[model samples]
Target: MRNLQHYTDDAFEFHKEVLKSKNTTKKDPSYKERIENMDDAIEGQFSAYNDNFVRNTLENIDSYGHTDDEKNDLLKLYSYKNSVIKNLKVKITTTAANRIINTCPNCTISEINSFDHYLPKDEFPEFVVNPQNLFPSCTICNGYKNYIWIEGGKRVFLNLYLDSLPAEQYLFVNLAITGDVITTTFYLQNNGDINNDIFEIIETHYNKLHLLERFSANINEVITSLENTIISFVGKLPLDEIKDSIIEKSNRDRIAFGHNYWKSILEIELANCVEYMNRFVTID
Candidate 1:
């Protein structure tokens, strides 16, 4: 997973903008005013999240229980997320979706087109429009992560904005070559360098998101791309030189993505696999 720059928009101001754009014809015309009156309370909840987030104790914050009518209104704010995103004045959500790295930070597998509420809006309605709580995500990871955040008093998902991903290698892939078929299996191990607590969370992250399975399912495409690269060098470079080129590419990707990036990790593994490298040497 990758770290992201957190949004700096003020919570109350953002809510006001969303509330202003909401269609108030169906509900109490004063509904907007009613919601606005809760500004202090909303800011308190925002502060609660900030404090607990810094302490890595977000689980300590309880879900706010509001009156049925009020809860409905707050939930509607989240529904207006698209409006919030599209509004030029409210660029916080849009800015997040347009980050330099365009992939979902949670999986780095797909393009991100939606925002995921780190704290599900249903549970934390007061934070419905809080940019700090919204993360840019692909629909797939967003659905897979749906409403599942913590278990056993530990965070099952990492807050990319708050949690600093480990620089050390933890995610690994083991390639099994059987005759002409190759199988890629991705797994996570602490690698003796990561903190035990951090690693536990990492394990939960992979399991909860089914990342290993997803990575394995998609790895064939990466392998095919690598094979195509090797095919181009078959007659032009020796085996060692070809392996070095693959390593160089992997290194570049690791810098562009991260150490645990699935593609880069697999590329390095393929580079070191003498048997796999030899397949390129004799390609027709």
Candidate 2:
């Protein structure tokens, strides 16, 4: 779904300016006082169970709903919410590290860059300039989802912008064609130490988000059609001059693919192709 949007060059600068003025949430004094009271109540009530501990009140954040002056449960809830968000930052950063995008997908400016996590300033006070936790999106997608609780139990805004995701997640190279294509709906999968978990997440997303099944036919055909495109790209070259032509063709495609994760890989591939061409072909 996120892969559909192409990155506009120089989108980073615009976001830098926006980041300065966004996210203005703070803990209410009333909320803080209530939480302290809850902790005191829980400590007094659970004093007897302290040693034989059936369950720590601290662990009830996800299970606890809410109530006025319910300090103990509120304490746990706040703690849990903060912890989950921190862990979420780790996930976002890891995703950003694996992705490759040179421009912002949000605003259409080349000067801007970053895939911003849509968390509000109120939500994550300390994580303002978290680059890894950010995406290469323009102000559009970022401004759109700020601090909103999205569907499901998870928050609404995307942690990693779709463009800031690795192509390996949604795309692959057809060895035969050298074209980029979305993985087959049935074939979509995840690989990692948490492969099963990630796979399940992706599979659920594919269905819930209606991703692969709904993708355009051309997405997959990008990779499948590469061989022909490459040949077509080289067709008019003189027989003795064909070697340089092939190297150049690969370079162009490499850039095309590189805008996603393969951007760097494509650059490297272009260099290797050029080297190979020079070794075998001599210009007259």
Candidate 3:
């Protein structure tokens, strides 16, 4: 997984814009007054989130604005997602989003199409419109990670804004080739490079998001594409040279993506597989 820069928009101002809009008041008559009354507490919660994120104590922060809400009227704040007033809907795609607009940070495979609440809005309604709490993600990853943040006193997923993703290799794949068919199984190992606690969180991120299974399912087409690319080089180069070229391609991919990028790692593994290389070796 990749880390992302936090949203830098003025969240409080945006919240005010939403609250002041006639559309918002028309939809939920009581929400404007209720939220205005709790403005201090809401701002405090924002401060708490920033402090907790910096201190790595997010799990310790208590849910605000939910202490007395029996009917959950505060949840209407989530309608900011549909707000067209003052072009607030565009706020979902922050400047940070442009960096990975097509690719998902959570999966690195799928196209990003939605924003996911890092802390579920249902449980932390105070952050429904909090820009810091939203992350751009694909629909599948968002669905897989729905409403799961902390469990057993540990954060269940890596915070893109807070966690520093290691550039060293952590994701690995074992490939099996039988005749013309190739199959792959992907898994993660720390390689003793990352902190144990952080690695555990990464493990949970993968498991909870079903990343490995998803990667495996999507890799066959990639493998076929790689094979086709490699075939083009068979008549022009020696087997050893072709493998070196593959290794070079992987190095470039690692630079473009990351050390553990599934495709880059897969290319490295493929380059090292003697049996696989023999396919090109005999062609020449």
Best by lDDT: 1
Off by over 4 Å in 1: 26-28, 86-99
What's the lDDT for all of these models? 0.80, 0.36, 0.76
TM-score of each: 0.90, 0.31, 0.86
Local accuracy of candidate 1 as per-residue lDDT tens digits, 141-220: 88988998978877888888788789999999999998778888899988699998888888888888888989988888
Model 2 spans > 4 angstroms off: 1-101, 104-115, 125-134, 139-187, 190-194, 200-284
Query: Once superposed on the true structure, which residue ranges of model 3 sit more than 4 Å away at CA?
Result: 18-31, 65-72, 79-100, 282-284
Q: Which consecutive 10 residues in model 3 have the weakest lDDT in total?
A: 84-93
Model 2, C-alpha of 142: deviation from truth (Å):
3.2
Better model by lDDT: candidate 1 vs candidate 3? 1
Estimate, for each residue in 1-284, the C-alpha lDDT of model 2 and write its tens digit. Answer: 23323222222232232332333348543543444444433333333222222232211222122343352323233221243333333333233446544344332223233335433324432223322224444444445445552345433332223313344543332222123222332235455533453345445433443333333332434333443434454546553355445456655644454332332223223334544233223333
Candidate 1 global CA lDDT score: 0.80
lDDT of 3 by residue, 13-70 (tens): 6666666753444655676777788788778888888788778678998886476472
